[model samples]
Target: MIFLRNILFYPAFYLGSVFFVLASVVSIPIGPAPLRWSVAAWSRFHRTCLRWLLGIKIEVEGQLSREPVFYAVRHESFFEAIDAPAMYDTPVTFAKHELSIIPGWGRAAKAYGMIFVERDQGAKALRKMVSAAREYSQEGRPLVIYPEGTRTPHGEAGKLQAGFAGLYKLIGLPVVPVAVNSGPMYHRFWKRPGTITYRIGETIPPGLPRAEIEARVIAAINALN
Candidate 1:
């Protein structure tokens, strides 16, 4: 039954994605505002599919950050990745460098203000990430980063990436860690049905020692595990 559900979901999700990408492309001449709308709509569409077809639901347990602060989210699966647009109101987000390569979709995502991180580029990439995040911060927008850098298994924790600390220190905003347990439900090839809870952890003030902030973030984002 789960396999059958996944079979149904794959086409629906991809088709919906293609529809939104085309909508974004057509809206290009008008400007990026419409692209943002398209992305939001696509996220809603995904949520609907997750609930109805896959019997999965999302539960965010804490208040979202309304101020211009940085959010450090747990990376357990692609579930939270697509849920970001719905999780917060047009917050600035970061993605892996590779996603920026996909032809049409990548262009639209870039226009949507996603900061693609090149994990291997060292200090150069960190500088670019900080610069882009600062501009968003100046605009009173919340920024989100996956502190773990990559997705780990459901019950395990990963080390906080250097870029997470680098951006937090330079962007000069309080960090709010968000923990989610979605791996057991949605991390595999055939996603299971269950609730994915997003718990907003305590906020850490800016300018703390590197070790302290990193330790706090690691503990907070893995709170669900």
Candidate 2:
């Protein structure tokens, strides 16, 4: 029965995503102000679909940062990337430049302030991230980043990337370390059909040197293990 449910669920989820993409494209040239709230609304709907369609429940512990801050999250499953915008009031992600090459999804990402990074052009990517993060922070939105650069296969804590440290120093904002355990349960191919927990830690206040901040983020997340 679970297998049957999974088979039926994916198609509906795909259709919902298509509908969202079409709706977002039609809404874009109108400008970001009006579209911002709508995007958040749709994201919530999308997260709901994932909850029902995929049977993955999410639990968030601790409080999100009170002020505009940067979130360094552990990436593992597709669930976190898709579900983040819904979890926060306004979220701006730092994603790879390749995501923009994708046809439909890329457009939606652009509308929601997804900052694209060119991995090959490291200096340019850091500069862009700083600028976007400053702008988004001023708007009182949290900038979300996967410091590991890519998803860990099964929620293992991967080596932290230097890009996060660079961004932390550039933006000079508080860092919120989010430890997540998503793979033993909601992994894509071997998904266990259960809950995924996002354990948020207290904001690591700014003013420390970049290395210290990076260590703090890593320590906070590792504490969850």
Candidate 3:
């Protein structure tokens, strides 16, 4: 049953994504809000599909802060990335710089307020990221970053990427580490029926030493492991 459902869902998901991407492109002239709405709508559609078609449910633990802060989320699968808009209001997600080079989707992401990071540029990239983060933080938008940089298999706790610590220090906002175990369930073609929980850990205030902040974030985000 799950296999059959997945077979039916894959095409629908891709088709729906293409439709929304085009919607985002058309909304470009309308402004960033409309483009963001299009993306959020896509997220909502996927969440609804997951519940109804795949029998997968979401269970969030702990409170999400209303104050603008850096959200250091564990990277488990693409599921958590798409689920961001559904979970937060106008989140500024940190994405790879390469994603911004894509044709229509890239333009939409920039207009919709994603922060692109040039990882290989070292110091220059860090400065750019800090500037972008500060701007968004001032605008009362929560910044979401996958500290592991890329998706890791479920139950694995990889080292936090180099950029996370720098962003934590320079952004000057509290860090909210979020652990999720969605990979085992949603990473595969045939997703299993279960609850994918976003376990929000305690908020670590800014201004802590580098060692302290890194330790706290790593431990907190890997709590589920």
Q: For model 3, how does the per-residue alpha-carbon lDDT over 1-225 read when each residue is reduced to its tens digit?
A: 888778767878778888998999999999877888999999998998888778889999999999998999988888988899998888999988989988888988888889998878999989988998899889999999998898888788798887788788788899999988888789876788788988999999999988898889889888877
Candidate 2, residue 53: how far the Cα is off, in Å: 2.9
lDDT of each: 0.88, 0.77, 0.88
In model 3, what is the error at residue 85, expressed in angstroms? Answer: 0.9
Tens digits of per-residue lDDT for model 2 on 1-225? Answer: 567657766777677777777777777888886566566666777667657866767888988876888898878777778778777767898888888977867887887799997888879877877887899899898889988888886535588787778788779888888888876766665345677788998788877887787777877775556
Q: Candidate 3: list runs displaced more than 4 Å.
A: none
The runs of at least 3 residues in candidate 1 whose Cα sits more than 4 Å from the true structure, single-residue gaps closed, are none
Full-model lDDT, candidate 2: 0.77
* TM-scores of all candidate predictions against the true structure: 0.96, 0.91, 0.96
Q: Quote model 3's TM-score.
A: 0.96
**Each candidate: RMSD:** 1.1, 1.8, 1.2
lDDT by residue for model 1 (158-224), tens = 9887767778778889999999999999999999999999999888899998999999988988999
Cand. 2 TM to true fold? 0.91
Query: Cα lDDT for residue 206, model 3?
Result: 91
Indicate whether candidate 1 or candidate 2 has the larger TM-score.
Answer: 1
